[model samples]
Target: MTGPAYAVLAGSLRARIVSGELAPGQRLPNEQELSVEFGVGRSTVREALRALASQDLIQTTRGVSGGSFVSVPTVRHLSAHLETGVALMAAAERVTVGQLMALRHLLEVPAAGEAAKHRTDEQLEDLRRAEFDPAVAVGEATYAANQDFHLVLLRATGNPLLEVITAPLFRVLATRFGRDHAPDGFWSCVADDHAELHDLVAARDADGAVTAMRRHLDHLTGAYQQMDRLSRAR
Candidate 1:
């Protein structure tokens, strides 16, 4: 019964917020004003604001100059939003691990090629460090270093949108998967591959970068299968 009216009101306001009409830190009209503006009751306006608040699109302040203001979500915030949703969807069997891997390949392969040409010298140095900056511990440091390598490559493409959409995949795999349990030599092999990838990027060898990235993904197939088994066990 409340869906059509209040949901519509929330959608209308959400549109304005997303379209830059509302803007970050901009205070929305008071409840009474919003109700009048949307031709709805105060309760409807309240419900709409509640919806936006739940989605992290707005925040309400309680002081003298307080009201709801547009929330400026960080990249982490946006990626976190996808994390729970995608995690739940996977749990519900609506998505498969293979499907996620495929999508990541679609995104990351091209990104590797792009990064080879676009990456700054500073980013290239970071890649070099990320490949080699692990301690003589278990695979934990190596696992972290692996994550850093992919993050740098995606960021090197200078595409914020790419990083936002794909980071959760790596996070979900690392957290719920058996990456920490990767065998002792596994980390060293990963480090070696990363070093090769670094050289490719430094050489501006786009073709070689793509080939190296694809082979690296191929090397991960067994690890991906291990994660799939772990997910089912949970």
Candidate 2:
């Protein structure tokens, strides 16, 4: 049998949105108008709209001068969905820690070089704020700082798309395989690496930043692999 009528209508509307036939922020036709256009009942039109809203493809509002409109996907929205998908894949063993690290190496090393070239003064300060003294910070604070450093570094590249692509991967790795699995002194090593990376980027040393970032990721790869192994074995 075929899918429900609402699903079919939703698919048609989604195609329009994807093709840019319905531009972002462009209000959709009223339910009655949609019903007549699609040759479906008004209830089917509402259901289709609801399905689109749930997927972040459209938004609906109530009251006068309000109706459904196509959504403009933000980096945060896209990254959250990507984070969920990656987390699910990781949980199912389809994405391994090694694979995640490899992807990071591929993307972030070059991003570091770009950051060194394009980072603004404000971005450098943000990266500085992400650093912490492992001697003083422990547990969750350490993890947050480390995550922040990479996020700031990605943002410093003057490329929001890099953050859009890379932030979710960091999030999936951290959330899926808890940070508590690292060995003694791991945080300290991370602290040093982040500090060195910050300095290299601040100095606009593209080559140095690239080298430092690769080395930093290499240092953490073993810890992440250990965590993945432990998580799988359990």
lDDT of 1 by residue, 1-234 (tens): 246788999998999999999999999999999888879999988888999999999999998999999998787789889988877876687877677778788888889999999999999998987876434744466667778889999999999888889888877767655665554456667777898999999999999999998888766756676667865676
The worst-scoring run of ten residues by lDDT in candidate 1 lies at 132-141
What RMSD value applies to candidate 2? 1.5
How many clashes (backbone N, Cα, C below 3 Å) per candidate? 0, 0
**Model 1 Cα displacement at 14 (Å)?**
1.3
Give the Cα error of residue 121 in candidate 1, in Å.
2.2
Question: What is the total number of backbone clashes in candidate 2?
Answer: 0
- Candidate 2 runs further than 4 Å off: none
- For model 1, the superposed segments whose C-alpha errors exceed 4 Å read 1-6, 39-44, 62-65, 132-135, 230-234
Question: What TM-score would every model get versus the actual structure?
Answer: 0.85, 0.95
lDDT of each: 0.83, 0.89
